[model samples]
Target: SRVSLVVVLCLFAFCSAEYFEEEEEFYPPSRFPIDPDANRTMCEIIQAKGYPCEEHYATTPDGYILGMFRMPQPNNVGPPVLLQHGLLDSSFTWVLNYPEQSFPYILHDLGYDVWLGNNRGNTYSKNHTTLSIHSKEFWQFSWDQMAEFDFPTQIQYALSKNAMYPKLVYIGHSEGTTQAFAGLSLNSSIADMLYGYVGLGPVISVTHMSNLWLRDLLELGVEWIWNVLGIYQFLPTPVELHSEFVWACAECPICCNEVIELICGRHHGAFNNSRMNVMSGHEPGGTSTQNIHHWAQMVKNPTFQKMDFGAKRNEEIYGQTTPPVYNLNNLPKSLPMMLYSGSHDELADPDDVQTLVTTLEGIVESVYWKEVRKYAHLDFAWALDAVDEIYIEVTDIMRDWVEGI
Candidate 1:
């Protein structure tokens, strides 16, 4: 079936590597921005927002040292909440918005300490214990490694520091959600360490997405070739150039909006036109080529499973002919989890979200689902009315959970 799908795709769209090469060249090398926040840290961004912030680091078992921003109130309270950004995103997404609208700030103001975790290879957490960030070994990872290493390390680190709260609530968006679900499923014991889990734009299997170019790019295995060519990093464009494109010159009204619609389906009134420039300042923060390749696997394959390391390596690593599916059945039965999906989200299609929910049926306890009719992939984090349409309901749900109601 996959073979036929690829065949059919080749007939409809140009499968020439030359075409993709001409369209999306390897990002030219980057120069640090001359802007004010060029060297800004996550804590610095949090502090700039007038929130009491602290930067913390935790070293994963694989030697990647992850960084997180902690916003604690003077009167620190129980049930700290950890927010993780999606692929090519950092903690900046939570703090980039207005204080009243920002999720992390809102939570901090609500008497809850908020922690934002950055996955390895992102802008914030690029340091490794030994390997260079440019090493092919450093790039030899996907979200599969993340679920196994990043989440557990960060959670344990947070728990150790905030001993006041025995457990903290976990929230993840997009790829963050993928790893959280995948990690927790494989090692359900991690669930015992959390107050609850929340997924904003949760994604697992994405074969049903409206966009097939991403699936096309991935199915062609373009990323593996880049790796072999020694291009370890996967910045789509440099932040410097990104800022120029968004800030100085662009189409009057629908410039950035058009591009976003091209990637994520057109969901009008979700993104603020004025703030697009500001959001671009810190966005497309970071990720690995392998991570994108891994994501493309999800986009093409229906099975919610581990990385497809080809048949030979799959046999060597998994002792199987194919990659094993992450049994959602293995998720702890009592783990309280909330999932928010958007109807217009082409990337996290409603059908796929339903499939995830269906797979977890009779397996987990206290699962809550919310579907926003007009929201798209980015809207979960970027929508102007998010506070009223999404965050308030989320906080209310979290409030009830905190009160053990």
Candidate 2:
């Protein structure tokens, strides 16, 4: 009887396998292959691509551990160049793809010590000395903390590590530029320590930003609503969600682009949709909801200003009825700066960029309003035509500056 039971169980198992195989034919699982390599550290990813690299870490003033990856020059001859990525973005932005299109790879090939920074709260720099990610203290930070504590700490670490150079060159994109402006504006010494700055889709003034819905959300005290809802970190990419999203985007492109366009503005043909599928896993990597609140506060306020804590708290923290504005006029007049802005950029609207240019007339070395039509905010970093439309010109400028130095 026991032998007969064993034989029956084995037959049932075989039949189940066969039945599932037949079912699989009728409803095939979606298999949009994602680039798992994106999960690697900046250094690990670079080394895997057969490049020379090193990882560096710095503890910020408030105890956040920031990460930076460096591509060393063989001779160690030129001034170091530091590249800072935008909000919810990691250092990988500098080397997101092939050497032909990557900013860090191009700079390394040009013989400069290239360093890419991962801002506080990003995947690479999430660890802190005293706080856990689950704690409210961890999410308590905003761009204010980044400007006051994170950026300066990274700059100090980079300069100290690369003591061979008297000063370093800083390149920032989007919120990278925003935090840099805040840091350098507050601390003159930090601004003076840089030989120059290059802002790629820089976000200095968002008074003319085109995202009305986002502006309305911020203006309507959405931060308080989110706080009540217990949502601190915004748009954190989970593994399962990322996989599902990759499939959705790949299988339903038209539908996906409509949603993406609503958030990041028009991409048209400028963006490589295939690359976006890969990038989606990494980008909007993660950021504090407070940071979004900071941007919203900026939108509601006429001047480029600090974070708002409402009337009573604003008076207590800032010693005034209103939040004090960051004085853009105080930026070092002699520091060389090259800025690039796209015509169709919705987040960093062209008109707002022009306002920034006018604000820093003497300091701006050059302003490139890209001629390529339909170029939007994300295009500077993610567009398929980035190499021809932006990187070539950027390389030329960097070459000239490096040679002159």
Candidate 3:
């Protein structure tokens, strides 16, 4: 019964990572202290981990309030780094591992002010100023809305609070990376506010996607499934029901690992299943069904354009024959970008990443690119060796940027 589950869910569960000199070598699950904060908020979990934490909120122009967690600088006001998680994930994604191995904590220990963003509709950011979350209109948005609203609002909020840091560094994984790409392209002013951009599993369009099960589902028509399943908010009901589904996975570690492999890719050796009992509690964070449908459209159609409404709806909504494409070429010519991709990532195919990089060639200032041959989509977030493999690379760049200023 270990069939692929991305057919139904587990599709966009995605991104994250590192830094330091001869720090205490903290290995996970064995040497690591277990996570008992499964039922806790990200701020509570961070506080319990003995870190100073603050909860911040930003209201997007569309009325949704995004919740963010900040790990303040220990002593001096170090450079600010804002992190965005991928589809169906929350800020909790960066804290699933041990302190030394976890990206947020490692950066915190390195004296960086870390800001974790929860995308709209995730566990933390579910509130809208005027709409009840139960209304279908509240769930009408996809990542299209996220790019247009969430990033700008969150980044501006962070910048507004901290006057010392003129511009914060931006880092994203999977769809996190996609939103930044789309956001920066659609609004060139985003580059003026960013010191640099780091994309852990930079996804544009999944041209050579390897998940056949997911691909087949997209091919079958998400609209048909949306109608058949009656899904508006993902999981029909949103938070409580989604939490129960994750609870089932947390209680069944073996099955959870199987699903991780199916959705993330075939590479599982790097995954840390020892603490899945805790991590799985936040595994499938939450998103709109329309978001997943939009992702399906990405797979079905080869373009990385805005979410496709059917031709008639497109005409009504966009005043066009088809949806408008996100202008990747419009990205600022001087935006320094760091891009990393895993060859084994099922969702972020190597070829697709290359296509994205090719489009970024003359648009961005400089690109630092690397591919991890064995890493799957989740490894960037949960792999045991990510600190050594990915985090150090990111931290090294951040260090240079901080020093130059």
lDDT (CA) per prediction: 0.75, 0.71, 0.77
Better of 1 and 3 by lDDT: 3
lDDT of 2 at 399: 67
For model 3, how does the per-residue alpha-carbon lDDT over 1-405 read when each residue is reduced to its tens digit?
124554345333221101123444343232333346765667777888888899999999989999999998755387788999987778888998778788999888888788999888887888999998767788888999899999888899888777678788998988899899889889989888888999988888876888776566576665566555445555321233334434555556677677656655665436666677576666666778788788878886788798888899999989997999998888988888999999788889989989888878867779889998788888888888998898988888888777532
TM-score of 2: 0.85
What is candidate 3's CA lDDT for residue 195?
86
- lDDT of residue 370 for candidate 3: 92
Model 2 spans with C-alpha error above 4 angstroms: 1-32, 36-39, 75-77, 240-242, 246-259, 362-373, 403-405
The ten-residue window of minimal lDDT in model 2 covers 15-24
- Candidate number with greatest TM-score: 3
Cα RMSD of predicted structure 1: 6.3
Over 4 Å off in model 3, which ranges?
A: 1-35, 74-76, 225-230, 235-251, 403-405
Best by lDDT: 3
> Measured by TM-score, how close is model 1 to the native structure?
0.86
Compute the lDDT of residue 315 as modeled in candidate 2: 91
| Candidate 3 Cα lDDT to native | 0.77
